[model samples]
Target: MNESYKIISSSILYWFSQKKWFVYSILIALFLLSLSTPVGLTLPAYHSLIILVLVFILVTFEPIPFPAIALLTLVLQVVLGVAPPNEVASSFMNDAVLFVMGSLMFAIAIVHQGLDIRLARMIIYFFGKSKRLFLMGLMTISAILSSFLGEHTVIAIMLPIGLSVIKNIDTQKTDGKNAVLLTLFSVAYGTIIGSIGTPSGGARNVIMINYLQEFSNVNIDYWKWMKHAYPILIIQLLVAYFVLQFTFPSSLKNIQIKGFKKKVQASDTKKNINHLFSCLIIVFIIFSWFTFNDKYGLGIIALAGALSFMIFGMISWEEINKNTNWGVILLFAATISLGFQINETGASSWLVLKFNDLLEALPSNSFNISWSIMAIISGLTANFFTSSATVSLIGPMAIELQPTDITFALSSAIASGFSFLTVISSPTAMILYSTGLVSTKLFFRVGILMFSISIIILYLMSQFYWINI
Candidate 1:
């Protein structure tokens, strides 16, 4: 009897220890819900506010898998009467969610075809002469590809190239280590900066575009979005390169890439044909997005691209199903639904009003102050939560602040993509962190500098450039 009792006790303790944060989060959410509603607040809005707070805490700490958090949010919306079952269900699926799903599948298909080998050879052939030139070429290639192919996809393709180069280095000295770190970060930061350049680059951009259209009736097409954001992307790329050079100054003057030509020669005819076909499919999808996105929508075009790969036998369904991260897609869908609930229940508008009251006491009357505050908040939040979630939470509030100020709304969303302080800040950062060459401490150290520079650049752009454009 005593043995059984001890076993049960141990099991209970272990479960509690494993889920302590989850329990704590639930308690805090319940405690907040128990409070009396503020003046002029409806019960539904109050309940949604409580759920939103819970989501932020749970998502930040991640006491459970992100998909579970998303499921919890969906259940609570109905269980707590924040929204009807039908309404909550409707929010679970949308164009943004579809786009995320389709994009992930397409990315997996493209990566499965093994085109990275050809890409690496091309990179080395072009930039193999010197260390500095190679770094520049890597960053430029990463940025240009990511601006259209998506940050996660580009990183998946480029990360191995960086790692391969590092592996080929002949020395185990500190200088060699610095060279490896700089090369990896060049690809990582390039992918990150370029993700803001186009709507197709990241899901946050699509979420923000959806929010703008739904809330303000403002439609920013693919071309317009690129035109507005590409300048910032270009400037950030330059800043990132210089900052990396300063931070991890290379000791080597020149380095030669060995056996690159032999590898290029070894590529067989079938692989080359497959790669060329994949390239054509990618080009077609990008062209369609730029030209026909308004009619067929970006999500549908992405899905069609994935279908094209399958139709042409470029990739198998088993590969895509095995490799794709569907949980992320579901999480995005739930957060978007939660954002809709926040807006529908007046929670976002209430928060905006509170923010305005807080800002009214500031001595500066300049609109730049407001824009900077919003950008800072969005950027900081993005460093912790994913950028898509940041946009979902803050996009509505920015629109509520001034629907007419398209610049302010779009800037707030785009600037949130400048998540540089943590590996969890963006998928590109997380992928680079997986390389095991980058320590978390080093990441934060370099990331903080880049974060500061990006914020200042974004603020200045909002003040002068974005305002004019």
Candidate 2:
């Protein structure tokens, strides 16, 4: 009994030590809430503003897990009477949340089938001899696959391929580190750029779609979304390839990826069948998303793919339950709820009103200035916060600012996916960083360059292509 008491005490102490910053953050938020009241804002709007600030700080510093921040957001909303309990609860289970959950499950099933090995073999078979060609192939594959399979899924599938090649390189050589960094960045930046290509590519895209539909009654279907964003994705993929190649030039003329094809061929017949079936299911899902998304949303179609995997016994629920990052799903749901409350309570409009003077100062000739400003704000904010959170905060404001110009508003949201500044900027970057081959400093160093290029590309697209579209 005495030993149990000591163990419990020690556990409590350790938890507090780990979470002290979070505790301080909560206290600071409450203090700020108590003292804050801008004139002409409703009580709920004021409270929402305080909560948004708290969330921004907590998410940026990340003293706790994202899900914890999300739970805190929901709890505070009810406890502070900023929103009704039922409304908050209802907001947490939207179609966007369901889509995230379903897509993650589908991703797990696809990864479980071990098809990426074949994919790696194919990539090497075509581009094994030339350093630049290999890098371009890897990036192109990552971009195209990510546009359909989502960035998290594509990165998870591709990271091991890049890591294996890096591991094969002679680390004693002076150019080894450069080769590894370039390869990893090819995968990382490719996935990041492709995330803006389609609604299923990332959660932020879906969230923006939901917001546009809900707030403006403007429905952007899958093909329409692709048309608007795919050109940017293609150009960015090439730009990332050139930027990575220029920044970290590989000295090796050729790389031999041995045994990948043999390993793929060694898989048994049953495994091959499973792989083929999984690919077909994924393709079918994408096709359906393109053809029938108006009838059945992307979330339901993704869940159907997951279900197909289960019915065919290609993947088990036990495996998915263990592998899935439920915290991310929960975080997305809570953030969506918070965004809804921001809009519902007039907090977003109030915030926009604060910026109205500056917006009015711009020349009245064209909306190019406003579009650039919105894109810059969204892109920069995404570097610190999750892309979904950035959209959740900014989407409502964009809609409030220009209810009729949804094309510009969505362009801003799409550009925010250019999360090229930090490890925490996007999940793809975090996954790549986890490989230990890429350093945080290197990520930022390369990211800032890519971020600048992305802004230029997006600005040009906004002015020329998007306007005509």
Candidate 3:
């Protein structure tokens, strides 16, 4: 009896230790629920806010698997009477979720084709001898590819090339080490900056677009999105080149391009005919996104592109299944559902009202002030959590803040791409960190400057260029 009692106690302690954040979140939820609903908010809205707080904690700490947290998010809505089962079901799946799924699958298909080698060859041929020119060339290519292919995919492709160049450098010296870090940061920053360029660049963009359409009845197609964002992307790229150079000044003026070329030549550099077909399919999908996105929606078109790859036998379902992050897809859907409930229950409006009250002492509650606040909050939130999840929660609040103006939603979305401050903020950053060369301290140091510059640039664009567009 004593031994059995000890074993039971030990098992309970183990579970508690492993799932401490889960316990803390539940306890916090209970504490919040014990309080009476605020005067201006309905009971349902208050409860939804509690759930939001619970979810924020869970997502940030990740005490549970994402799929489980997703399930909890859906279950809490129904249990708390925030929404009915049917409403929850409907909100759980939407174009934004579909777009995320399709894009992940499509990215997997594209990455499986081993195009990074070819991309490396192009970079070498164009800007290989001069270090500064090579850095700019690499950053430009990474940004452009990430603008369409998504930053995570672009990082997976570009990191290897960056490392290849770095491996040839003399890392034992401070100059060589700085060069290595600079190359890696170029890839990472480029991918991050370009993620705001179009809807396809990141799930956050698509989520924000969905919010704009659902809340404000405003539709921004791929072309319009690029028109608003690509200029910012271009400007950020130029600024980032200077920032990275200033942060990591290396004495290495030139690199041995011949060595990299020989390495590429030794590899199986033969082009596959199927690659052309894959490229055509991708181009067709992009063209369709630019032309017919309004007709079919971005999610449907992205899925169609993934299907084309499967239909042509260019990528197998098994490969995609193995690679795609279904948990994240489900989480996106769940958080999106939670976002809908927050808006429907009027929690977002209440929060916005409070948000305004806090800002009421200002000279004027103008759109510019609101835009800057929203951008800074979204940008900072994204640095701590995943950008898509950040948008899933914050996008609704942004739309509620300015339902009539699309800039609020757009600024929130674009600013969320400033995931430069932390190693775990975005997958691109994580991948770069995984190379084990760049330190977290270095990341934070460089990120502070870039993050500030990005916010300033975004504000200027919104104030100047975006207004014209």
Q: All candidates' lDDT scores?
A: 0.85, 0.83, 0.89
lDDT of 1 by residue, 149-266 (tens): 8988999998877776667664467677778788889999999998999999988899888888888889999998998889989999999999998888777432434544455557
Of candidate 3, the 10-residue stretch with the lowest lDDT total is 265-274
lDDT of 3 by residue, 366-443 (tens): 777878899999999998887999999989999999899888899999999999899888999888888888788889
lDDT of model 2, residue 388? 80
Report the number of clashing residue pairs per model: 0, 0, 0
Per-candidate TM-score against the hidden true structure: 0.96, 0.93, 0.96
Runs of candidate 3 with Cα error greater than 4 angstroms are 1-7, 253-255, 266-271
TM-score of 3: 0.96
Candidate 2 per-residue C-alpha lDDT over 344-450 given as tens digits, one digit per residue, 9 for 90 to 100: 89998888777776778767734676677788889989988878878877788877778777766677688789989988888898887787767899899989998
Residue ranges of candidate 1 with Cα displaced over 4 Å:
170-172, 253-256
Could you give the candidate ranking by lDDT, starting with the highest? Answer: 3, 1, 2
lDDT of 3 at 411: 91
lDDT value for model 2:
0.83
Better of 1 and 2 by TM-score: 1
